[model samples]
Target: MPMPHILGADHVVVTVRDLDASAAAWAKLGFTVSPRGTHSPHLGTGNYTIMFQDDYLELLGVLTPTDQNKPTQDFLAAREGIERTAFTTDSAAGGAAELKKRGLEPLGPVHFGRPVDLPGGGTGEAKFNVFRWPLLENPGGMRIFACEHLSRHTVWIPELMVHANGAKAIARIEILTADPKAAAEHMSRLIDEPAIADGAVWKVPSGGRRADFVFLDAAAFAARYPDAVRAGATTSGAAALVLVTDDLAKAKAIPGAVTTGSAVSIPASAANGVVVSFVAR
Candidate 1:
């Protein structure tokens, strides 16, 4: 059988210039980020740095000063900004195998494990069994990486480094891309999901749980959504968003929150655009 469309967004990776600062700020907001780690010789190049979560946010940057030096300056050159969205799928075996049949190459079923300490001082560890697979044919364009969380500890949101709120819901993602229509058709056919478009916006939900991406013209969308703000999104090419909250008053009380507008939002639109709305835990 064909592989599943998405198991959920699994985790989002952002390339940042300052790991400590970003991790600290997000932690203050409740996300649990792991200590910084250098790239493994196994991952090729051995020049990457990362932070983790079962369902986590990867803060990638150069590993050391030498890696940050000259010819390699681009890697650390102030993060003029780079962001990529990742989709976690149901079957790594089936997905990778199937993608290979379609002429795509997947990296591995490699695993990543790390120790984690909680805000209350309790400590534990987690493991990640992952495989990097191909989605779009373009080498550096878009891809799918399978991830499994092996944290026997805390109640963290497996896919995100963000705290587990036990929120029973996930929002859809709409990607604004160069060829929304084609992307929609390809993804719909590949994942067996119904795809539609209103111009160049391709929309699809992470096969399992919940998460979606719609690719469209960035400028046009900001205008259409009107009250959107891209606060804590991946620098990745794909657009990330959070919608207006239903209770601005309530959301404000939450720490680390930065309100954008006046009107409140429904739970449905929590991650709809580029913002943070009061969502149910």
Candidate 2:
């Protein structure tokens, strides 16, 4: 039997408290969104709009009062800091076979996708022949799911960036936590990578042609970039995705962080930092 191939990082999702606020804020970070958008009425999946790219950032939060007609623990209120790593794949059957053969456990092979009409007058849908970490039955810990696009789009960001012929950038996504070793080990096990073997620190490579994943402790992350901890982000289970930029003043032009004192220590070289509004911290 042939082995199933593991794809690179898909998208990082940060659950937020307010949809309108976060959507407006993230737009400044170079994300032009899609026309189709809605907050989940059932599972909180409806309360978000996604920006397409090689590695897109998902701004997720709670549904508004109108959407709250039905009660659900999942999206009724946004958990303070829980960060979920969402992934997608082309071959769910192939991946499932590979994992099962290896005696690995997965949460699900649930299918959730939508259809979009073509420009000409026909309709096509995105299929999710994928598996999730914590299955739909038990959507534990920040909600994880796999997406399988049926029809490919011309403007795929993550694919373009990953398969770029030139520029080997984004060496790794350094995730900070209090337990560097545990976080590293868990993610490593989930994604089939090596354990970090230290206090909350691990490195998972995106195979030969992909960037690696590096998990670090809060203290270590702060040490590497002193501007982080001082940013006044106080969420429970999320991360501060400090994207690198060239224009600091342009970002500083934004009005929120300055008024709320959300970002205090702007390391001269840290570009213009924005408090990840979706994460609440």
Instruction: Give the C-alpha miss distance for residue 74 in model 1, angstroms.
Output: 7.2
Per-residue CA lDDT of model 1 for 72-143, tens digit only, reads 234335332224455665555666676677676776666656545555666655555666654344212344
By TM-score, the best candidate is 1
- What is the C-alpha lDDT profile of model 2 across 196-221, one tens digit per residue? 45433566554443445566666755
Model 2 alpha-carbon drift over 4 Å, by segment: 1-3, 36-44, 47-53, 62-82, 115-125, 135-145, 154-172, 195-201, 208-211, 227-238, 242-281
Clashes of 1: 34
lDDT of each: 0.46, 0.44
Prediction RMSDs, each to the true structure: 6.6, 7.7
